[model samples]
Target: MNITLVLFLIVVGITLVITGWAARRTRTTVQFWAAGRGIKGWQNGLAIAGDYMSAASFLGIAGLIAFNGYDGFMYSVGWLVAYLTVLFLIAEPMRNTGKYTLADVLSYRMSPIPVRSAAAFSTVAVSASYMMAQMIGAGSLIKILIPSLDTTLKPWFNWTILGTKLDPSITLVGVLMMIYVIAGGMVATTWVQIVKAVMLMGGAILLSFLVLLHFGFNLGGFFNAIAGVKDSKTGLNFTQPGILYTYGKTQVWGVDKALLENVSLGMALILGTAGLPHILMRFFTVPDAKAARQSVAWAMGLIGSFYIMTTFLGFGAATLVGKSNICATVAPKCTPNSNLAAPRLAEYLGNSFFGTGGGEFLLAFIAAVAFATILAVVAGLTLAASGAFSHDFYVNVIRTHLLHGHVSEREQVLVARITAALVGLLSIWLAARVGATANAAALVAGVAFVIASAANLPAILFTLFWKRFNTWGAVASLVGGSLVTIWLVAIGPGWSAPRPGWAPNRSLRRDPVSTRGERPAPLPYIFLVSQRDLVGLIALDVACLLAAAMMLRAWRRRRTRPPLVAAIFVVVLAAVATVLVLLGVTYSLVVGPTFIVALLVIMYTARYERRVTQR
Candidate 1:
């Protein structure tokens, strides 16, 4: 077998062995669902890291940094800090009250049927979005890791799937994820995550150290070198944030609008972590609330270090390896797609550090780690989605309709396994149909996070803190928020950027380069060419509107101008902002929903308290 495939098999084989071991121990429902709460603090922490740090963190960010520079690190900082939200607001409470899944916490006091069904919908939506990113990334990375797959499979494996071209590795992922979760349950999923996490961390640290050692450990020198030269791909300054925020450097309106897009995406990242079903579920894997708390701390350390190291990898590839070479060698999936940066960097380092064979070994190793990263993450997502399906939907909602009594232990386990397999299969089919892009991971993850921030986070927060948050509010938050996010994503720039003649000049990349310099610039790249900003606005507004309505209805149907006023203001403002974005008038996707969500929350809750006391 080829080295890449061999390494891939080794990683999969080891995980499958773990799955067998875990299956034997996974007899009881609790064991199948949460590993019987027997996981140690460190082990669970590593698993969390593994789940959080996917291809997005390892490959996507490094490629982003290699090309986009400072704006790329925003993902790093936002994700690490987001853990604080989880630790303080979510982790302990979730562990304290929750059982198998996050929906348990939502269903704790509310009617289990509607609340859990809504929660299940939100979980599946988020998991599907997140899983899509990893799926497309796994498919695209094969071009570089195993070029033959791209050449041979794309031609002969031309059997179209879901109307998209096929790749063998991409198809294989669906099978692997299904088997891992269905066969082993939480024990297998946790161990897989832990193994991938450890390998990922080791690989990142080693790569970072080698990059530093190449520059004689001089931090200043490394910074100077990165800043001194423009990016080889697009010739932009290497330390600017405009790559994510600016239109082509020449368009004043598009350039300014980029800021709003950045804020919108950042907001999602900051809030989404607390609501991620896979992440929140990890708390139950630990023994107690304290270990759950401790695990976040450990995760923050490891994740922060990994993100920091990614900058070095990005700049290292841009500087030493040359973007031209990477694009040439890993083409149709390099530079702009940027997921190839880490692998290319590893290969470069291997050549620099050892010689010819060195690159082959290093490339094989990194390919395995990245492949393992996708598998472990997909397994976690599948577990969360399927857990919600079985525990919340089947047992809590659907089972009650068909059966007279509670769902049995064996029934729950059987349903969960079946649901997980279905989820894995669906994700593979959906992921296979997706085309490759530079921000594949970011695009998918961003949608999932924004949806969580909009739909799940508010419900979770209100359920925990707002004593008066009723079933209506929780249900509205989940359903209304998810619908809005999904609709916005469907219409947003990300999905709609290719309207035949939107720009007509060719590609619509989001690079921050300008023609003011001696070198000519390419076509104008917009901040939200992928339209994350539009999704953010809709998410924030939906969250506010649903939350406010919940309070208004709960208060004896009393008329309130505040909700109406806020809605009018938001609608008017959103129309104006959307117009500006479409006409290239402004980039203020950041303005419409900024204070509205917070304002609605404070107003509604306070009003509820006053009305209750007076009544």
Candidate 2:
């Protein structure tokens, strides 16, 4: 009966109808998986933008800017700049070689058995993590918009059930997106993404204009408003330390005036962008290497412009909305979470459209757009993972039965749908479980970056240029990087401690404190040593360096000999990683020891390569 619900249902209905129409023509596996590889360059480029700009960019980045300030911009900068590297390096070659997915390119030379299996496993892991983040974001947006909705509703709006009270809007999005992706595959997904991108860009442009208009179209006036606000009690100016430092107890740039954390995050963004399964796979949807290159160029322009607009939105939120309004609207708790910052700002500027009585229609419309954002992103993620499963895993590996007997395209489409549903369910369960813990979005995003950087990046880069690159070496790097990243996160300092009364100790144990006459000593030794920090650094260093070394060794061993391109790529990778590590160590001793160790490993790898070449 409500206007908000009505608007949402209409959108969902339209999306479902379109999806059904698109799917009616599916006649082959290629058509189902890659949209018959007939997608236009510009069209796929827009879709890539949609896939890249998720709730994280719209909600998370703005929240970061609203809360943290400069560090938040650093996140945006890191992400956008990464695309420049992708445009120059990875895009064209990937499209030229692969038929459908990253697995297709990486495993083209290897036997379908283990190579396809590894690629599929990695794709599923990366895609699942990314999807869960989108789903959680959807749930959070729903909770905010439909504050009156019950915990559950079944079979066309019935009664409340178990589970947290979800926004009916999120459920609406989930069902609609699932239907669209399941029915039409890439065709429906691409068009939906394109439409959503246009809407999102338009919304952002309007919001920015409105904010600027509030300041009489004066940029200086807006900044002046932000600079003027200083809390009397805290005695700190809002814009002084930048946003991130002001929001968190910890400094944004880093401790001891270092940029280690920033550099680490930056490296992750730069190298990781090229390796993302969903983004890389988009290149395959286009016609040729040239198209793939052009697509990247277009993506950079769109993404960059969008991010610049987001900066204005963030600063506008901080200046116009104020901290109190943001805290109340986004997160009621005093805890600093950047995810709600942008939405809070929107509600503030559009207050006449929200809160207590007037703009209910407008509020619902914005909420619907936010809901669409999550749905589009999640659908893309599901399609990417499911395509890997159906094409790379099932069709490629379980080939004998299907190859000998004629298999119907309908059956293949059915298999993909089943895989999508299975992946969606698994991600939802994982997200629900993880949501109980703190900072679920950040953790998931971090995992995605680490997987892309460690597992896929090395293999992808090597395959393109390295003549000696063998299948075994690529496999080693993929498995090695993935497992190591997982281990580091599990045991690293970032790991959250168990809640009180949940653990046997009933309190967080920070190593085991050594006492000096009832007062704590300077250091607490665990396992007779202070090994926690050392162990983590060493593990990360080895994981990155060893993987690089493995790839180099493989490159040197090929009978065909190394090409100029391959040699240049190896050197460039070495230089970038080394420079980043050194920059990271400049701030904290925590990374220095690790950097030295990594350097030593690199030197040894170089020496080994030389010996292999001579032999």
Estimate, for each residue in 1-615, the C-alpha lDDT of model 1 and write its tens digit.
577777877998999999999999887789888999999888888999999899878887887777777778888888888988988899899999999898899889986776888899999999999888878878777766776645655554566765766656676776788888998999999999999999998898888888999999998998888887574445567776565556443443454556666777778889988888999899998889888888888888888888888888888877777556656345565444466778888988988999998888898899889989989998999999999888888887877754647777888899999998888877877877666553555667788998899999999999999999987689779977887787666545556455432322347443333322432232343343346656755665576566545555544454654545545554555555555554433243344333434444455555556665588
Model 1 accuracy (lDDT, Cα): 0.78
Q: Which candidate number maximizes TM-score?
A: 1
| Position 343, candidate 1: lDDT | 84
**Which candidate has the highest lDDT of all?**
1
Report RMSD (Å) for each prediction in the order shown.
Answer: 8.2, 9.1
Tens-digit lDDT string for candidate 2 (368-486): 66666777788888888998898778877675333654446677778888887777656655555555332667677788888888898898889888988876567666766776676
Question: Which stretches in model 2 have alpha-carbon errors above 4 Å?
Answer: 148-173, 230-258, 328-337, 352-359, 400-410, 436-438, 494-496, 499-615
The list of candidate 1 runs beyond 4 A from truth reads: 148-166, 231-236, 240-244, 247-255, 328-337, 437-441, 500-615
Candidate 2: the clashing residue pairs are 63-338, 68-243, 68-244, 69-243, 69-244, 151-165, 353-359
User: What is the lDDT for 170 in model 2?
Assistant: 45
TM-score of 1: 0.80
